[model samples]
Target: MFQDYLFFGVDTKVHYSYRMLHLSHLVEEAKQLHNLNTNRALLLSDALLGSVLLSSILDYEERVNLRFHCNGDFTIGTETSFQAETRGYIECNENSEVVKQLDLGNNIIPEFQVRSMRSQRKKPNLFEGLTSTKANSLEKALNEHLAASYQMNTVLKISSWIDSVSGKLNAFGVIYQELPDIPEEVSIKLKKHIDSLPSMKELFLLDNDADVLSKKLIPDITKAVKSINPKFVCSCSQERVENVIVTLPLSELSDILNKAEDLEMKCHYCNKNYIVSMQTITQIYASRNQVNSTNSNEMN
Candidate 1:
């Protein structure tokens, strides 16, 4: 189950700085993730997953992360920004070797199931991690992370789901923060409302939109307070890749030249390739000292 996608869209540089996105309507079909085709249903789920994360970071301007780890397959994990509109990936291998990088969209998932296993399996990057199994859902897993790690004194949850017949997707998530010396009645009422809300998927599936969901759960006192528009953005580029290669030690460059007549590198996130032929390599090495001398002269 999912409801309308909602977030506070803030662009302080603009005239109308912000507005609330219903995420009320999504394209009938799913968007492509790399070369893979994502189902509309799955896209909605992914969007909701991104939305909840965006809200947490955007509205309060806090540094937070939602990650996935388990004994199950598809250990794709992502962490969002505390500063910019970005996210990063944590990639893993069969032997459970994990590596972190800015390439996140490449982390593929096979199936949607966050189920509990018996006998308590133990291993690295496990036991303390969280994830959602139902229809690839992710909100509850995030809530648990906030509660367990930050020991946050707040109410937050992301409820998302879609209908089986219509195939449309919707999502809504709420986060509440407290100020020191906050009112006792406010805290008590907020807690009750949070407890009374329906399952996140249910909230998204049946509700009108994010606003409706919020009103239904916290009928009286809750305020629009803030909203944000979550976007699917990545940080990868051709120039950055070039800078990396150019800065590598000459020995590493020599190795590549010795092994192959041409040197080629592909960006992991963008899949764009850069190729340097043996001729270029030879010329570059020959002129290396001269080029450095000229650059030094220019600097002085």
Candidate 2:
């Protein structure tokens, strides 16, 4: 059976601490909470390093955020899952040549995803580990992500196969968390135990199943894996983007009008952009003025 709490070496070094999470339990909660498929779930573990990111957002909660930026064949973005599972995706100017010019230096094929963060804000964003090359290793880049965006120190060692060749879905992962309250001595023992563990890919494929593998790795980790959660959710619509344009200052709305007769916006997480005509802009500006005027009078 998989054991979560264990010892690596003799101690005086034996100290008391609580850190780490059950990968299976994490996935089960996700399944019960979302309309997802078990077959499509992945643990996304940095198995080499022993860590994972865990997040859950309700239909209308403003707590979830994701950003994507990569200089590769694919696009980049950030998104949120809102109430009733409604979601929103955002990204930088993807149409430009900035992607093609990336320089990956002596690293694995570049992959970037700021999958988790300590908090979400509406301020200007800072790009982390954006390689100067066409590609870099996905895991190393993520190390930068953990440090820069998440503001949480992490070590990620991910190992999973990528096979676009077969056109079949096949990927599994695991995430190990280190609780902040863990004392330094206990931390040392845990790290040593983690080091002695087998490779994640081998551990990930134990007995031909991810859940089974999770058990094999930490049978007593107090983990619960009922079913896997559904990912690949997209919730973008024209009305939402319209609401965004309406919030812009009248001058900003007029500026879009000056540049062109219409404005186009897209969801970065998914490859969907929208077109706003001059008439649409005019009405948005008009509504914005009304709201502003009412606020002004109320203030007086």
Candidate 3:
């Protein structure tokens, strides 16, 4: 059983906080949900891991938002709530020429968007940038986005891979940030050391130990912040789908009813199917008419 969570340690002496993520299980779940092939799955797994790492720095009650508009076959998006629940989907044209580019390891220059939603009532603070994706290396692109768009001093390393025999997917990642008080010399040293460290693929396959990895990367840590396990969870439900179906144009609803066919709605996030019976549509139509009549009578 693969455990998934984000772990953080803060060194007041160095004025820096270190974070690590072990998310093999979560990545597997997400790939299965999206039905992605190896390359596509690797790309999306990297994005999801980055989203989770980014969300960790959010203030209380804030959520992480990420979007990608690429000149490729598909547009991908992911969101993580303040509570660590994540959902995402990919939209694509079946016969898009960009699909060939994606398969051939060509650069698909993607416009990346990142943001933090403070609350439901307030507008989200947003950041955007563009990067040329080189196969499976999203960390480099995301790091550039952070530096160019947000001007934050942070370093991230990611690794996502699939088993050749079983086709099982896994991911591991790390992020280190320099607080305002940290001296430039210390930051530089840490960054150089982290950059020189072995890739996540090598480290994960050699020894999947978080504590050992932390000590090897950053030898100083005065405190450990809270740790959390994030999961891929969709927010769709049968009731929500039903409410949406009832709001369709009356003519459309009547046509479905006349055909005596049950309407099926598949959620993009989880691919769960919801069926709406004609009887339910009829009841909803009647209820809508009654409310409209009542409002008109009150106006008179």
Candidate 4:
């Protein structure tokens, strides 16, 4: 059981930043929770790893969201907090055309519209970027978004390998960004080194932790500045579901009350079901009327 972690470090002299992520466990958990096939599981895994990598650019208490709007109304998304907590979801029915196409071994990556958003806690403002790639690669789209939107020169690599015998997934990613203060010569050398690194398949075959991988990425990095454990955590709860129901129109609440049966809701991320009984619906309806009446009196 390999523990998942994100390792952060900086070049001792050039000040360039590096982030290495080992998140196969998180991806495995997501695959099990969603019951995804290999194609869907790989897409979600990449999105999850990419989101956590993108979170390294944010400040404390900030969060980043990565989304892919695929053809056939299918979508995959992931959100990662600075604390390294992450969740991801894929939206498409098993019998949908998109899943059918995937089953047929079609490559739908080129039709994806990728969106990245960053925001801080309690802040209403968001910094967002959208980009499309004809390359049929998620990493390329992500790099294009960062370059076009944030004006950052970054190299990102994401890789995954599944054990044939055990059916276990092994995924990792590394990002390198040159700081503004880094000398142009040093930046050029860093790019050359990055280009000369081993192929993703070769890298994945090596048994390495974040520390070892970070050093491999930037040999000058003496120590990691930060390390975070990334986990698959969905922020859904029964209370949150109730709150969502309370926001619905009174007519909708009344309709649920009329049925006299529980309204069942399933969380898309975790597939957990929550039952909202008629009693709860009636209470919500009454509460809405009470609030409306009080507002009318105050207005008068």
For 48-111, candidate 1 gives per-residue lDDT tens digits of 3543444353334333344455434334333334332333232335342221111232333433
lDDT of 4 by residue, 39-108 (tens): 7787788788788988986664478888888765578888888888999999876667756877566765
TM, every model: 0.55, 0.54, 0.76, 0.88
lDDT of each: 0.44, 0.42, 0.73, 0.80
TM-score, cand. 3:
0.76
lDDT of 3 by residue, 20-44 (tens): 8888888788788778777677778
Better of 1 and 3 by TM-score: 3
> What is the Cα-based lDDT of residue 244 in candidate 4?
99
The numbered model that scores best in lDDT is 4
| lDDT score at residue 163, model 2, on the 0-100 scale | 26
Q: Whose TM-score is greatest here?
A: 4
Q: What is candidate 3's local distance difference test score?
A: 0.73
